[model samples]
Target: MSQIERGWDAIAQLDFDAALAIASRLLNNPHLDIRHQAYRMMGMANYRKRSVQQAIPYFEHAVQLVDNYKDRFSLCMCYALLGDMDRADRLFQNIDSLWGLPVECYVSIVMCYTEPKHFQRAVDLLEKIKLSYTLLGITDQTFLAIRGQLAFHYALDAVHYVLNMVSASFDTAKWIKSFAEEMDEEGKKSLALVSDQVCHTKGPFTINQPNSRLQYPLLCKIEDVSLFEEERILGIRVLYGKLHVG
Candidate 1:
């Protein structure tokens, strides 16, 4: 077998050191394609080895040689993994379309948002994924579970933002109600409890209410949100189960 094929074989076998060695040798090849492949192999090997920082330059080199979807996507993943959300977001935006990408690719993209608590973006992407699955007449239980997890996080984050007074105009109650509508029975119940708590504390006061007496109730709501810890734990357990199965 050629060295490139051998390098790929080594990567498949999880022998990252051997793959890196082979790829390193090919880096000086005369052909651009060969050099690009070498860089990609090295990047893949390092990434699989959990050497994410080491992987970036190789992926960057590959992209420099051939600025295609696959290389750019791989580089974007590296940036996301490194917690460089701005760079990753930029790369993701540059991609023309996610059509025809695998479900795992979509999941990875969602995770780029989800991991950094960018829950709204994660939820939006999940909605798009669901639409794509519907258009293609595809139904998968694993995807459904993943959707639920993402949705749960989105709801939780919305509540968190409201409780923290991060955004003045955020309609937490309205968002919770809308999210609850699409949830399963258990999910709906959980969100219902959260909604009730929010409403009870929120009372008749708007966030912009200048009344000091009303401010006390809003302050109390911050502590009230913690009362749903059991629900939060349950949701987390469900997420863990779904992720484990997937």
Candidate 2:
């Protein structure tokens, strides 16, 4: 196998050290694509290892070599994880072909937005994704799976926003009420859709903990299915009570 192929294999095996070592060897290669791949692999290894700060420069170098949405997305994720929302937002704006990205990519972007309390942007992106899926005439089950994931995140974000607003002294009663209703609706939708056999039986429904890397709460699946369901119900109940009580 080629050095790049071997590097990827190492990454797949969770051997970040080996992958980084192989990638470093190819960084000085004459071919631009090879160098770009090396840098990309290095970045991915570091990112997967949760050394997000160390991953940024490698991803930046990879993107400089060849500007692609995948590398740019990785870079944006690193920035978002580091709480540099400004840089992440800039990279997000520059990403092209939003409709062409995979569902996981969309989920990651939504998480990035919600991480920084940019809940409105997350909602807007989901609306856009739904419109795209409709335009593309995607399969019903596939659409439902994507919708379920989006609803979960939306409900989760709503819960977060309501809690923050309630803790603050601001007069957020109207906004809290609005989000409470929205959260309940979305939470119900999420529970129904995610529980559908067709939605969680196959595809990316079975979550795997590859390593110590951070996993998004909404993306938990399979073994955590019951936990997810309970959380959804609890969030809705808690938010409703909070809004009604005071």
Candidate 3:
């Protein structure tokens, strides 16, 4: 195998010493791809070793060499871990500046929401995006197709985690009810489907349903959203299930 390949292999094997040794030599490689890989390997190795402070510089340099989406994401994650929320937020916002959001970046952003400190902001952004779609009444096939690809489970999973797992100061229940109340039938279907998927129940799967099978916001009453008891119960049961899952 090539030296860079070997370095990556070592990184995968959790041999940071060997990976660093190979990466150091390849830092000056004429090929940008090799340099990017080498730095990424080193960064990942350090990150795995819990040396996040050390990993940041490698990721930073890797992004400099090749504005690769994953590399920028790694840099953003590193900054987030380092308690530099502002820097992390800037990098995330800048993601579409060059290329549109990569599929994996959606996962990264959702994972960020798992952090307690960033949870509220992440939920706010998610709610805003979902609301924008509702406001636009984006039932267009092309838009739905693109949105499905970009979001899929990440956005819903983030919301699920916050609702079920987080102990936040913010009124999460109120927000969830508000979001559901604001969505269209299709949007409600998506939310309901995600809710069911996360809760591991087969009671209602509306994402693939016909117009006749649609339910607005699925589990809550629109006229009286104050009755979110069922959702709260489901969230509790799902949280318990999630906690015990391997």
Point to the candidate with the largest lDDT.
1
Ranking by lDDT: 1, 2, 3
Per candidate, the number of residue pairs that clash is 0, 0, 0
- Whichever of 1 and 3 has more lDDT, that candidate is 1
Screening candidate 2 with a backbone cut-off below 3 angstroms (N, C-alpha, C), the clashing residue pairs are none
Q: What is the lDDT of candidate 2?
A: 0.55
TM-score versus the correct structure, for each prediction? 0.60, 0.57, 0.49
Which 10 residues in a row give candidate 3 its minimum summed lDDT? 237-246
Off by over 4 Å in 2: 97-104, 135-246
Model 1 compared with the native: what TM-score? 0.60
Candidate 2 lDDT over residue span 1-246, tens digit each: 999989877866668899999999999999999999999989987876668789989989998999877788788777766667678777776674452555445555554443425556766666667766666787544543333334344443233322221323333344323323444454444434323332223222322324312212332221111212111111111111111110
The Cα local distance difference test for each model comes to: 0.58, 0.55, 0.52
lDDT of 2 at 47: 72
**Candidate 1: segments with Cα more than 4 A from true spot:** 97-103, 115-117, 135-137, 152-246
Cα error, candidate 2, residue 120 (Å)? 1.1
